[model samples]
Every structure is written in C-alpha cells, then in structure tokens.
Target: MAPKAAVLVPCLLSLLLPFSSLALTQDICVANLLLPDTPSGYPCKPKPAVTADDFHSMALAQAGPTLAPFNTGLATATVKQFPGVNGLGLAATRVDVHVGGVVPLHSHPEGSELLFVFKGSMTAGFISAESNEVYVKEVREGELFVFPQGLLHFQYNTGNETAVGFAAYSSDNPGLQITDYALFGNTLTAEDAREQGHLRRKIGGDEAQGLLRIAEILKLIKVFFGLSAVPPDGRQDYRCSLLWTCGV
Candidate 1:
C-alpha cells in the first residue's frame, strides 16, 4: 500500500497535535466523520479538509464495498455510525444478489430484519408464525420480507437480471448465525454444544477441545480479514464479538 500524502489541512501538526490528537484515536470524535450538515446533502469542511483516512478506521466504505468475494455487491450501515454504534438500537445495509445466486440461510440471534427488494425479481422470506416455523414469502420487486426476531431467512435470485436489495436490521453486528455455523464452524466444539442442551454447563477440563474450537474461529477470521490477534488485556469472545474500546 502506498503511504497517504496527507489531506492538505491548514493547521500545523506541531500546533494541533496537542489539541487534536484526540481525533486520531478516539471513536465518536466528530471532528471528521460527521460531515457538516447542509441543505444540499453534506457540506464539505471548508478548511482542514478530511480524507478517506478520517473514516477509514471505522467504516467499510474505505474499500468501497465488495467488488468480489461477495459474488455480488455489499455495503453496510454499521460502518456509518460505527465509531458511535455501541449501544445504538439499529443498523442497516445493502446486498445485491446476482442471477442464479442465493443468500445462504442465516439468523440474527440478536436482531430482526425488514428487507425491501428494489429491482429485478427475487424470492425472499423468513420464518414466521412460531407454531410451525414457516417462512413468509414475497416474490417480484418493490416488496418486503420481514423476519421476526430470531427466525432464519434467505433470499434467492429469480430474475434474468441482477437483483438489488436493501436489508435493515435491528443490531449493529448481525453476523451469519446460521445453524451450521453455530453448530459446526464456530467457537464451540461438539462436546461444548452437547453440554448446551442440558440445564447446566458441564464442569470439567477438556482444555484441548476448548482451545481448538476458539482457535478455529479466531484463526479463520484473522486470515480472512488479515488481522493480528486482538490484544490480550481487553479482547472479548471472537476478534469481532464487537467492541467499544476507549482509553484502554
């Protein structure tokens, strides 16, 4: 990666470092991300211009959403309020489904969804009516699919053209809580999962099994995102169990 040449600011680093060093390290430091509100969209700061660097730390838009690997387009709203997202009530995002594509089944144990199809034909639905656990369905565009909290759902491409969709969720980090992921590809081993079915946690030392499972998820996430391990002192759960760190 090339070194950034800096975003032509009017202030001297020597002078502002004492007063604005906080902007570089603090989350919710609105010195930058929250662009000045204006009548026509956001007004650019007239001086002390902001660059992609300003939002890079907390937003995925730094990379301009997915161009590949996603097999379709992806954009996130968590990236918008991230520096201040902690404890916030909601988050939103958009994902485009390509022709002959499918969104693998998943659930948000902590959130629900309201997806609106904006273009092309698509089939989207989620588990509804707890009694039989049926998924309510919607076909064609300009329609909606609402998944009650904790229900599994999926969307499939059904049109000749690419399908565009918007997904709104209730949590900041709504990961792929697919049954397979939680049961197999996660931070819990088969033994650990077995214990979960009982009323109490099994008390015993199977250190190797526990370590192996956590390592599996952590290592995979690290390789996927090209990250080093989370720092030891205050890290929790997975590298992305979510965070709100400050002054630690």
Candidate 2:
C-alpha cells in the first residue's frame, strides 16, 4: 500500500505543476528604465510604482529635427524612450524626410520592420540577401511596406514635399546600423579595410566598381559629418587611399 501511494502522489504533483506556474505569471512588465537592462529586457517596475503613464508616450508625437545630407528626422518609441514596451517585443519610429532627402542604407539586426506612409510619397527598397537583387517600390499615403529582418534597406523622398512615415518593429529594442556609419565612421585602420576588401571581392567580385562606390560613399560621409571632403579630382584609387589613411 505504501509503495502504491508514493507513485500516485508523484503523479498528482506533476498534474498540478502547470497551474502553480501559471499563478506566478504577470499580466504586464512595464520597464524599470533606471535599472540596467538584461539580455531579455529591462527589469519590470515595481507594481506599486507602475502607472498608466508608463504605457503612454509622446515621443513620436512631433516631428524630430532634420539633419543635413540626409535631411531626415526620426522619432522613436522604443523601450528606452517609452518604458512600457520592455519585454513586449514591439517598438515604433517616425520618419520625416524632406524633399530630395534620403534615409540611407541601414539595417535592423534584431527585428523585421513595417513602414506605413501617412503623408507625401517616398521610394523604398531592400536588397535581397540570398540573391543580392534589389526590390523597390514607390509608397504613397496610406500605403505600406515590409522589410525583412537584417536586410539592407533605404527610403528616399520622391515627391515635391515632405514625406512622413511610421515604422514598427517586432522588437522592443531593434538594433540599428547605418551601412555608411558602420563602414566609414569607425576607427578601423586602412590595412584592416584592405584585408577585408580581399575577402569581399572573392565573395562578390567587381572589386574595382565596389571601390569606386565606396570612395563616393566615404566622400559623402565625410561631408555629412563635417569632416574634410575627399579631393574632387575623382581619381578613384587616390581618393580611396587618402580617405582611408585619413580615417574618414
């Protein structure tokens, strides 16, 4: 009888474990931004201190200031700015592009993005990672587009006036890397770039054309960041060499 009772007790405990776990689950975990974040997300605010205001934010209500070269502004509502989205796996950004402006090549490593146009029009595109083929479309007011995770993409204002769009991400804190800034805005030495260039050519080919485009991009980055511009003589090798050595 004792042996039979022990086995039955174990079975009953196993059956009740799920209910105990569910009882421990939380309804919401509004972020406690004052604390350091973890791999999963910011720690939850104390229930006593959490409030309705934590879930509401005006961070994206107004157009952020535009900057030169890109003539673009961004207002983001991520966990850091909005506190309520931590561990929620969602965030938003407002993009405003003036006439003739562009949001340059960039990628979000952590999340897929969806853009909804609310005003004016813009041309948007993302490069296919598997085939390297470019896919583009002109999105106007009330239209939308999706960019898959970690793909290089861009948006350009194609209309006569300002273009405004709201972008949402599948992550509470979508990581961002602008291609030009990642490449030319760093402290990497010219030798490091040269070594990496060899591998790039072996994989993609057309090293010469790639170098030309790189030089042009470097010049634009330098000018945009208020650094000295590359010489206008346009000698590809000379321009690239000087720009690299000067750490542009």
Candidate 3:
C-alpha cells in the first residue's frame, strides 16, 4: 500500500503540471493603453478592472468624414482604441471612399489585412515586394480580399456611388507606414530620398519635375488626412503617380 501511494502521487503531479501550463497560456490579456506600447503590445489591464465596455466601441457605427480632397474616410479600432482587443491578435478599420477617392499606398509591417467590401465597388490591389508585381481586382459589394503582410496596397472607389469596406488585421496593433509621407513629407534629405526610394533617375535630374512630384505627393497626403479634395482631372493621375513612385 505504501509503494502504491507513492506511484499514484507522482503520476498525479505529472498530469497536473501540463494542465497548469495550459491554463497560464490561455488567459486573456486586455490592453493597458495608458502605458507605452511594447513590441508585442501594451501590457495587460488588470483582470478585475475589465468591463463590458472595454469590448465595445460606438465609433464604428458612425461614418467618418469624406469631405477631403480625396473624399475618403477611415476609422480604425485597435488595441489602443478598443482595449479589449489587446493581446487578442486582432484589430479592424472602416473605410469609406466617395467616387474617385482612394485609400492610398501603405503597408502594415507586422500584420496581414483581410478586407470585406460592403457597399458599392472598388479596384483593390497589392504589390509584391520581391518582384514589384501588382495583383489587382475589381471588388464589388460582398467581395473579400486579402493583403499579405508587409506589402504596399490600396483600394480605390471605381463605382459611381460611395464605397465602404471593413478591414481586419492579424495583429492587435498593426503599424501603418504610408509611403509618400515616409519618403517625402518627413526629414529625409532629397539625396537620400532619391537613393533609397529610387527616385532620381525617374525624375531625370529635372528639378521642376521633382518639385511637381513633391507637390502632387503633398496633395495626396492632404487628401488622406481629410484636408483637401482630389481634383476631377487629377484622380487618374494621382493613382498612376502613386503606383509609379513606389516603382510598382
């Protein structure tokens, strides 16, 4: 009986160890956005402090403004805005684009995006980093599209009416890097911008052309920030220049 008890206790300990480990890994971690974000995400909020409201957002139900030059609007729900999503490995955005508007060239460095179109029609595409090849499609209402991680991509309203899309990200805080802003709108020197961005040869050393490109890029930025509108004749040019600047 003594030997049998010893064996039973050891076996029980081994079985319980695995269950404890699983329990530790399965706990949900809500975000504490008041603190600085870490590489993974914000530290978890205390379990006792969490409530139903942490998981809900009324902002998503309202439409964003579309009066800018691009006539585009975007509302994002990330771990910071929706703390319940912290450590959940997911986030989302609502995009609205009037006719001729575009969600400009940008990339998510840490996450992939899945888009579901719900209103009107649009042309969506992503450019491959390895080959600079573009995969484009005309996406209509109820259609879905996936943009892989770290690729530059965009959506443009092609139908006569407004277009709306919902995008889900694979990470709680997917970082966005807009190409034009990163390259031209910031502190990067013109020489460095040309070399790293491969812009010099394309402009053929024409100072006026370079300035024109910068002006156009600024317009796109204004459109994105809802500060300006895309001129009717310039919409197609805007689309072409954006793709070209990225060497896509």
Show the colliding residue pairs in model 1.
none
What TM-scores do the predictions have? Answer: 0.46, 0.72, 0.69
Model 1: per-residue Cα lDDT over 148-215, one tens digit each: 77777766665678787777777544555754345444554444534443323245455545555655
Give the lDDT of residue 97 in candidate 2: 89
Residue 15 deviation, candidate 2, in Å? Answer: 20
Model 3 misplaced stretches (Cα beyond 4 Å): 1-26, 189-248
Local distance difference test scores for all models: 0.53, 0.79, 0.74
Candidate number with greatest lDDT: 2
Off by over 4 Å in 1: 1-70, 79-81, 84-86, 187-248
lDDT rank, highest first?
Answer: 2, 3, 1
lDDT of 3 by residue, 1-248 (tens): 99999999999888866434211354667778788877555777778998889888865676677634356888889887888787677899899987777787889997999999988888999999999999999998999999999999988876789889999999877889977667545664444534633464565555655655666566556454433465555553333333333212
